[model samples]
Target: MISTVPHNVRGVAASCPQCTSSLGRIWHPDMRIPRGWALAAGLFYLLALAGPFVQISIFGRLQRADIATGPLQLTVQGFDLVGFLVLAVTIIFPGIKLGIVLLTLFGIRLEHQPTRFLKAIFRWYPLIGPWAMVDVYLLGFLVAYTRLTAMATVHLDLSLFALVGLMISMAALDGSLDTGAIWDALDTGPAPRPIDADHRGGHLIGCHCCFLINRAEPGMACTRCDTVLRDRKPDSIVRSWAFVIAAMALYIPANLYPVMLITQLARTTPFTIMGGIVELFAAGLWPLGLLVLLASIAIPLVKLLSMACMLIEAQRPSGRHLLGLTRTYRFVAFIGRWSMIDVFMVSILVALVRFGQFANVQASTGAACFAGVVVITMFAVESFDPRLMWDGAREAAPETPPDPTLIAEPA
Candidate 1:
């Protein structure tokens, strides 16, 4: 009776009171509406890329910064890794996502749908969706705007407006998307998979691309989406441990070193992550200061701790609060990217504030280390599959454990 439905709820959060599994989407959205929203988002995305994002003036010195300018400045300052990270998330990934959406939807609408081609492009739609972080970038811009206004005159530009529009459109498109329905449309034929021949017999393997359940071996291709299937993610435990350990090593330098160096009137001051948060509070902006503290400091610590706990639990599967642990994993995975707020803020400041010692901002080594921690943690989460937690619990009490997959209908 295990339900294999994907847990992506939109309407009122309804779950089976008995087992606590999410009830799938309460209401399906019109497919056409999503296309329109995607189109609008794509247009705004183009506009946002074309014009100046913001302008700043300090002591009669003016600097104009566009979306790409921050990443360019970071590279110029020798933070190539951080620069490439920002550029991929803010610009390249977003464009790729939009293109995937438009092409898939258009292909689906064709008289003779190109199922294989559509499936190939759409497979990446969800995988890359989270990395397209336009909304997070806007929040980073807000923090940067506050800092800029405190020191000099700042002007919002057309590109900023376009970015705002793009964010809204992307939000709407995501809200209205029915991934289940799209998968259904693309799956016009039965999954083409090999028959299980092992003595133990193959277990139910979920396709990572389409979420279609298939009974197959670890390395078999999914019948529906053709994605390689595995009993669990390959080397999930070991990879997670490696990433977590590396991130822990970087966490020390990320905290100890200065993330940004500011020069004012021939005097330079270095700001660690904590120092920036303190400055915001000193300026009587405790709300924003609190946000920076949570996003940059508290969240990363919690994520690391939670991940460690989950890794331990996976080793010795138990029945105690397994659901809570799974929920924690999801929360950590979702908020991990928000930690990039400080990195983005540093990039913006570097791009906008340059006055040759009178007033200037430069990214430092700490920024690069912190970015590594964030990106590495995200990879750790991705590498560690949550289902391993449930599988562990099931193994501990095979008869007593209620199937976690049995609560809702499969999408």
Candidate 2:
């Protein structure tokens, strides 16, 4: 059942009881404007993708690329997985997210009751929102722009400006979306029966996709959405461990090998992750250099270490710093995808800079490995259950007794 509590005098927090996932905040005076922002973002997205994003000139040779160029070039160059990933995050997912937001907001205005399909589409907004990654892609473009400037004359195009607008509009749209208020607008049907507290030791499951609370049962489909409900993510610890191990193993090659090989006038230069950062620094682009350092080098290492620490802590009976660990898990989950910045950068460079040996960018062995690290770590974060970290603390005995000195004297 939906529960609302005062977060402050100006706003309140709404959350689902079963999984305790927050629905959204209800603000006093309700200043949200999602529809307008969503429509603006959708328009900006179209402008971003419609024409050349950036133009490059090397030795009087001109080359221009749009948003699709990167993914198409990656696929042509046999990095199909990376290509599709770029397409999904940079183009497809963002487009779909904006479309859904616009549609849902418009539907709410036009109809008295939103259909189940519309609700389902709206439900996917939060789940897919993070993966949109336009902000990350723009950062990738900045790195790509810096690298391009060193080797060639690069000029930002109209689409590049449009892309920036799209990113801003998307951020605004997300900030304005009040899921609880939207759900309330759509709540025309009978309220769902709350799961019986006594059922199966009071265990209840919340649909991961829809956040619908229901009694915990094996292989049971969610009544709201058909997603299978589980008390905890199935084999979360083991699967997360497996993904972490694989990511850790791949991390070595990801940094060691050249992520991108540049062929300029038949002089082949391979740029490893660190080598690229050092070059950026040598070029006096310290900010971009530090960005690559953090996204490509530091983020993967931090994610691996943090996941290992959380796993080890969760396995132990002592749940010291449970809240801290949960926060850490959330951070890891949120930041893991930003590591894809380098991968996306590589894709764009590989697509745009090919001038038949005068200047060419090609994906190297490390590109695939680094992509693997990012993808695997993302999966690792998804598979881990933060609740497991609290399980051990639940079983722990009370370590301290009530203070007798503070007790009031019997009168």
Q: Could you say which candidate leads in TM-score?
A: 1
User: Taking the tens digit of each residue's C-alpha lDDT, what string does model 2 give over 53-167?
Assistant: 8888999989999999999988888888888989999999999898888888788776454567677788788778878999999999888888888889988899999999999
What are the clash counts of all predictions, listed in order? Answer: 5, 0
| Residue 330, model 2: Cα distance from true site in angstroms | 1.4
Best by lDDT: 1
Clashing pairs in 2: none
- Mind giving the per-residue lDDT tens digits that candidate 1 earns over 1-411? 234343354344445433475544645677899999999999999999998999999999899999899999999999998999999999999999999999987788888999988888888997898899998899889889888998889999999999999999999998888777888888988654543323134577767788677777789888777889987788899999999999999998999999999998989999999999999999998888999999999988998999998998898887678779878987998899899999999989999999988999999989999999999999999999877877877788776544444343333
Error of 1 at 312 (Å): 0.7
lDDT of each: 0.86, 0.80
State, as a TM-score between 0 and 1, how close model 2 is to the true structure: 0.87
| Model 1 residue 373 lDDT score | 95
**Residue 387, candidate 2: alpha-carbon lDDT:** 81
Candidate 1: lDDT of 27? 52
* RMSD, one per candidate, in order: 3.7, 5.8
